[model samples]
Target: MFASSLAVVLLTLAALLGAIVAFAWAWRKGHFHVDARAATLPFDDHDQRVARPWETPSQARERVQAHGPPLPPGPGEWGGA
Candidate 1:
């Protein structure tokens, strides 16, 4: 029982130390620095204007005001069978 408990404690400490080391390494490598454009890499112009069905008229107007007119999705784009 004592041996198992000590093993658990040691394993936990090792895992914590590993996490700290990885975080420090990432910080030093500039991995934590992010550019604004990087956040939009996954989206294109069409994605920015696509209409959302769940939005109310006011919300839709707000979206249009912010992002121009919303484009309707192409046929089958809504995942119907």
Candidate 2:
């Protein structure tokens, strides 16, 4: 049991050390230079897909009746409506 505990402690220390080294390497390579650009990546053209907005139960039932159950929209559709 003691040996297993020692191994776990060693592994934890190694993981922490590795994380510190990786962070240092990234810092040196200017990965942190452009804070705003990184923050806006989710808004880029390729990544700008909007999440499906919530609909009330009545709206869902109406949509199902009109459109035969909800599905992902085609290119021109907005919310499949």
Choose the strongest candidate by TM-score: 1
lDDT of 2 by residue, 1-81 (tens): 466988999999999999999999999999888777678654533223322347677766775665454555457445343
* TM-score per candidate: 0.55, 0.37
Tens digit per residue, CA lDDT, model 1, 13-66:
999999999999998999997777899898877877888788899988997897
Return the lDDT, model 2, position 66. 52
Quote the lDDT for 42 in model 2.
49
Off by over 4 Å in 2: 1-3, 36-81
Candidate of highest lDDT:
1
